[model samples]
Target chain A: EAGVAQSPRYKIIEKRQSVAFWCNPISGHATLYWYQQILGQGPKLLIQFQNNGVVDDSQLPKDRFSAERLKGVDSTLKIQPAKLEDSAVYLCASSSNTQGANVLTFGAGSRLTVL
Target chain B: QKEVEQDPGPLSVPEGAIVSLNCTYSNSAFQYFMWYRQYSRKGPELLMYTYSSGNKEDGRFTAQVDKSSKYISLFIRDSQPSDSATYLCASTLYSGAGSYQLTFGKGTKLSVIP
Candidate 1:
């Protein structure tokens, strides 16, 4: 089966600029998530979507970060007025269902560098 | 304390040695435990998973979960250079929603010297 797919393997932008990352989850996956992984840290959940509706976004920095998963198959994460501290890897993951362990399959991730 | 705590180790070991990695969690509600292996510039891949407490072995990898102690462990037997990578431990707790929340550790880096 095809794994999750992410676009723009790497990105570099100046602080205060805006950037967006795209992701395509595996077919038939009903749950999708976006996470941010900083250097020397674990991936932290930014948002989660069940189909086209949002399941959680409590940790998301709404003032600067926004995400959408329209139609439930593809997702986009945007960071406006990016800060130097916002540099990190953006990861996308998906699961077929929410039962039991709900093992997530992840994409290669989009690396961002804010200068 | 963090929900999950792990030693961020660049542990180096000779080939054919036994490697043990562990993580501790403060949340007793966590019932699902998983271990993931990640290579440089690649996303994490699930290596092992166990439900509740007990041990599950696959190939040369063994996963142990002790809910009473709020600890989980992964053991690799006869470790090889190919096994060098970052290992992440994750735990999840069931919620009122159909899904659960997964919390991950900082990950332990392992290097098997040839």
Candidate 2:
């Protein structure tokens, strides 16, 4: 079985510039998630998707961040007019079911450097 | 206060020694506990998971949770260099919709000297 896959393993963007990261989860997994991990901090849940519908995004910075898991498959997380503090690693993960129970398989994160 | 707390230790130990890591959380609602290992430049991988309380063991690793104290622990016996990485403690409630979203602690970095 293949693991979760992500693109642009590392990205560097200027402050206020738009950036997007993509994620392809493990096959047959029904849950997808996006998280942000600032340096010296743990990953924070940014958004979660059950199939194609969003289940939670309470911590997402709605003012600048958005994500979608269209068709219940590959997902994308975007940040527009990004801020300097947005410099962090964006992680993507998946699980076998919506009731993940803390069992997750993660992809190599997209490290975004917002200068 | 942060809902979860953990020491971001750059913990160094010799191979074959037992290693212990821990986390304390404030949310009694968090009933599921997990430990993840992250290698450099790689994403976190689930190492162990426990239910509300008690202990679970897998091979050389053991995970313990104490709901009363809101404390959790992970112990690795006869550790190996491959175990050198960041160990993160995470927990969450049983809410239906957002069950996949986990609350994480800053992972503790462990180095096992050969």
Candidate 3:
């Protein structure tokens, strides 16, 4: 089984610019998550989707960040007018409840650098 | 206090030594405990998972949880250079309606010199 796939492994943009990251979750996985990991900090959940509908996004900054999972398969997270604090790795993870627990498998992540 | 607390150590040790990493969580509702290892520039991978307070061992790694103390630990025995990475401790509630939000520690960086 293929693991979660993410694209644009690295991106560099000036502050106030826009950037977007994509994620393709593992097949048959019903839950997808977007997390932001700043240097020296742990990954913080940005959004979570269960089969295309968002389950949780209280941590997401609505003014500058937006995400979508269409057709319950692929997801995209976009940061508009990015700030310096947005320079971090965008991690995508997927999980299933087959084991009666939430065991997530992560993608390599897209590193963003806001100059 | 943060949900999970860990010592962010750039800890260094010689190979074949034993390593101990720990975390303290504030949420008593977290029923699942996990340890994840992340290599530089790579995403984290699950190293251990356990429910209830006890110990679970796999090969060179062991995970222990004490719900009463709200403390969790991951011990690496005969540590190898390849084991050098950032270790993150996480806790979450059991699966319910497919909603599982994991709270993670800041992570402890470990370096094992060959």
Top-DockQ structure, candidate number: 2
Shift in Å, residue A78, candidate 2: 0.7
DockQ of 3: 0.65
Query: Each predicted complex: what DockQ?
Result: 0.68, 0.70, 0.65
**Top candidate when judged by lDDT against the true structure:** 3
Root-mean-square deviation (CA) per prediction: 1.0, 1.6, 1.0
Clash pairs (backbone) in predicted model 2:
none
Candidates sorted by lDDT, descending order?
Answer: 3, 1, 2
Least well predicted 10-residue stretch by lDDT in candidate 3 chain B: B92-101
Give the per-residue lDDT of model 3 (tens digit) for B18-52: 99999999988897999999999999999989998
Lowest-lDDT window of 10 residues in candidate 2 chain B?
B92-101
Q: Give the alpha carbon lDDT tens digit for every residue of B6-113 in model 2.
A: 999989999999999999999888877999999988899988888868899999999999999999999999999999999999997654754545889998999999
- What TM-score does the predicted chain A of each candidate obtain versus native chain A? 0.98, 0.95, 0.98
After superposing candidate 3 on the true structure, give the runs of residues whose Cα lies further than 4 Å from its correct spot. B94-96
lDDT accuracy of residue B86 in candidate 2: 95
Clash pairs, candidate 3, are none
